[model samples]
Target: MEPRGVVLVAAGGMDGRGAMSVLYIYPGKMRGNGLDLVARQHLQALSEAGVKVECLARGAVSMPGITCRFLRHTPANALSFLPAAYYYGAQSRFFGAWACRLLDPGRHRLVVAFEGAAGRVFRRARASGVATALICPMGHVGASGSRAELAWPAIGEERLEEEYAAADRILVRSRRAAETFIQRGVREERMVVVPGGVDEEAFHPAQVRTPGPFRLLFCGRLSERKGIRQVVAAWKEAALSPEQAELWLAGSEPNEMKAWLDAACGAGVVRLGFVNDVASVMRQCDAQILLSEAEGMPKSLVEGACSGLATITTSEAGFPVQDGVTGWTVRREDSGGTARVIRQMADDVEAVRRMGASARQEALRHYTWAAFRKAFREGLLPLRQSAD
Candidate 1:
């Protein structure tokens, strides 16, 4: 079946530089993040498939190939409430519906919600007979409640439930997340598991640094849920003397984690806050560590694996890494167990190299963008036909 057209509404900003025809709708101004990269990749894939694509953001600065549209009202927080509020608001809902209505009838066949907040618009589109899908990075609900939710009680579970029920299809990053949606009232068949993909060309072993000290790297927001504190504590417990290995953290630290870093009293841990050149850091590191309490399929794991780094991640990461083969999978809350694993890997240079090699091989075999594009097309095909 030929696709009419697809509209992607994401809380995250759009970065579709090249596409035959693509339209990306952001909840607020676009910022550089995982979503932006994914948007760019999506456009590239769709363009290669001979689809036309255009991109726009509510409050985004214009990029090279994507068009930017501004929404008068600002969203609360792109990560949390703002998108939810937009999804529920009458004005945003009406605006989206009207926009979709104006799109040449039969020209566009599907509307995809990139994040939860985009649900209302997509729901309205579906109500208007357009096929709808929600592309969630971490799933419909946050597995572990976010810091924003904890700090502000206003972001309730009820709103999330509403978003879950509204979508025609829920695109998730892992089987675990698909299960989460099933529990949240979405039918099993309505959910699709399209694991996140890595740009092998950009994040490959060739870019990594070689012949260096066993550098341990941790990338992601240094927040409690990300388990940055646990990782730091584990490193301390492992007690690798200065010459053995060093911990390199490349991400923005949350305020709560700052005190932990100040109290740690160690020079071995290097905190490089929010570095854009992540590939460089990945290359320098011998292993990548992610102790997140909850995740969808983390991009870091894919990138780390692609870059030939032995990854130490939590079960929440949801990547199909074989235990003792591709990388080490540790329990989310068990710092002691995690530390033991890291120490063991660090102690054996040959074992670390072997794991890194396997990790790279696994990434190349399964996590490439080409694989993801094929899966995405297959997953959406049935729904597209049903919409017809």
Candidate 2:
């Protein structure tokens, strides 16, 4: 039996003629925010490039020339108590199983899935001789150093390895992310590095710098995984007076980190909890910092660069922060190194401006969605050929 809510949005073919369609599975809602926003862009990119896509999601998007199918609900609602990794893994596998029952090899040539959610679907597609692509939005689990302490248990390392093995192509967000897969024995040829994109117009530099202290922004979840503690420690160690420099944290403060964050608040950290206009915040700030221990290409850093703010990051953050050009790339958890970088940025505003200019140029050249769409279309060429 066919699943409900399967809308065949248009009668047109790929390029207005018959062509094998691609199956895109996202094991969650398409809510147009965060990961959902990224997924939405991927769908639009493929559709705009004249590829017919049949997307299976928990919720659907309204787009011309595409098929959108959605399940009424997912097990995730009941399993909310589980750890995030475990919850998502279970959801992915469940969605994969349901999608498999509806799989039509004659209609769909390839299957594209995100992360560990659709490993089951990858294996099934391979068995049916349909090529499969896996989009790993974050670094490989095996390479997730300190993050493994929390992530590895629910999302076991072996699960991702199996997914990687079954996938004909693996799309990663950075060269750093690709290296992690290579280290885990995935072939280099199978990898396609698609750095996450930013909206260049929406995040452009302020024509005039806002008048204030030398403000540095940290604009994501204030969690241990984000290395927020290290960022605060570094800011305190820099010893810049509150009037001279201020550290602004612009994301949700998790309950677990409240005590630490409260202490940091007294030492020049200003909580701008859950900002909706991050670009506007970026425009007002002198620099952006993210010292995450592991990531795919971080969207905040990319957007920061696009917004013409110098970025301070760790290499593991998966953003290609050209040391001293775009911003500083400090070692993860190295509070002393981060402190030195912070002090330098505070003392030398002119150099920071130069870095911000360079960063924006780099982002416009390489990190816009236009660049991502072109690269994505090219990456699909070989798969399309094989499917034909």
Name the candidate that leads on TM-score. Answer: 2
lDDT of 1 at 271: 84
Give per-residue CA lDDT, model 1, range 240-330, as digits (tens).
8767888988889777678777888386788889889787778777888888766778888888888888888877767766888877888
lDDT per residue as tens, model 2, 59-82 = 777665567777746655567678
- Model 1 scores a C-alpha lDDT of 0.66
TM-scores for every candidate against the unseen true structure: 0.79, 0.92
TM accuracy, model 2: 0.92
lDDT of 1 at 246: 85
**Candidate 2 Cα outliers beyond 4 Å, as residue runs:** 3-20, 81-83, 143-155
lDDT of each: 0.66, 0.81
Query: What is the lDDT, from 0 to 100, of the residue 356 in candidate 2?
Result: 95
